[model samples]
Target: MQFLSAYAAALIVFGILDAVWLSIMGRLLYRPTLGSLMLDNLRWAPALVFYFLFPVGVVHFAVLPAFAAGSLQTALVNGGFLGLLAYATYDLTNYATLRVWTLTLTLVDVVYGAAATAIVAGGAYGALRVLASAGWI
Candidate 1:
């Protein structure tokens, strides 16, 4: 459980940092095309894991603060970011949905942490219990 909590927090923090960075970059260069959006930018939306992780990270870091600060071109990209983040976050959020039966932002990280702990502990306990009953040394 402790390990799960730590790993999950790390993952979320990494995500927040990546988003802030993307939003920042998106606000900066104002790339003319997604083609030149950035390396690995918006490249893989289809992949369930790590999809939009790169592009979204770039766009989030680039655009978010600008939007909060009331910048012009910054807000324009919000729609695009929303589309990407929605899907990407959805993919990432799915990590927890299976266990808790809910898919809200709150459960996104919670489920991941809980599931990890449950899986690890369950496995270990099952193995130990079986070993003990079997009289194995």
Candidate 2:
């Protein structure tokens, strides 16, 4: 139950933050360079898949570990590293193989991913701690 709550909270936080970032900055940043590859219309299926699955990865690789250890600091560092790795795997692969990919986009995305994940994990962990203390967990 605790793990489930933490996962749910973290997913919500990440989804909201990413949506804002993608809307305000991501479209402008990627469209110019990857215009040909960018979809003309949003595809709900794949977008939803990525968004949902990505948080699961964070929960498994980062959040759960910190929660198990009872260390919010662990979540911060591990979550950030996990996010960096996850984003780098995609961005770096694209930068290497995709001619349209740019360093600017890659840097921005990886950095954003790391920061966002760290914040989400930390916030989720703190919230869970509060809930547990209040006997709400």
Candidate 3:
């Protein structure tokens, strides 16, 4: 029950944050930068897979550990590092292999990924703490 609650919290937080980020940055940054490479319609299958799976990684790598340690800082730092590594892998690979990929996009996305993941992880941890305190979880 506790694990499910934590996972749900992390998933909800991460999905909301990432959706907002994509909605905003897809116009302001990605579309402008990637232009033709930007698909008119999103590929939902892979996107859904990523959204679902990413939170599991977050819960396992960041939230669970921090919850055990009873330290929000642990969640934030570990989440950020995980985000950095994941985003950097994608962005750097694209920059290296794709002609359309740019340094600006890579840098912005990498930073956003780290920040967003940190926020999501911390938010989930905090929510769990609140629930536990309230005897809800």
Q: What's the number of clashes in each of the models?
A: 19, 0, 0
TM-score of each: 0.27, 0.92, 0.96
lDDT per residue for candidate 1 within 16-129, as digits (tens), equals: 654564576445422322234246545455543562243333234433333345443443344334434544465465545544323453343344433332332233333333
Using lDDT, rank the candidates from best to worst: 3, 2, 1
Candidate closest to the true structure, highest lDDT: 3
Please state the error at residue 31 of candidate 1 in Å: 2.8
Model 2 lDDT per residue over 1-137, tens place? 87788888888999899889988885679787788787888899998898888777777777778878999899899889988998999999999999889999899999998999898888788877888899998
Candidate 2 pairs with clashing backbones = none
Per-residue CA lDDT of model 3 for 8-115, tens digit only, reads 998999989988998999999999999998789999999989988998899899998999999999999999999999999999999999998999999999999999
Full ranking by TM-score: 3, 2, 1
**Error at 42, model 2, angstroms:** 1.5
Stretches off by above 4 angstroms in model 2 are none
- Which candidate, 1 or 2, would have the higher lDDT against the true structure? 2
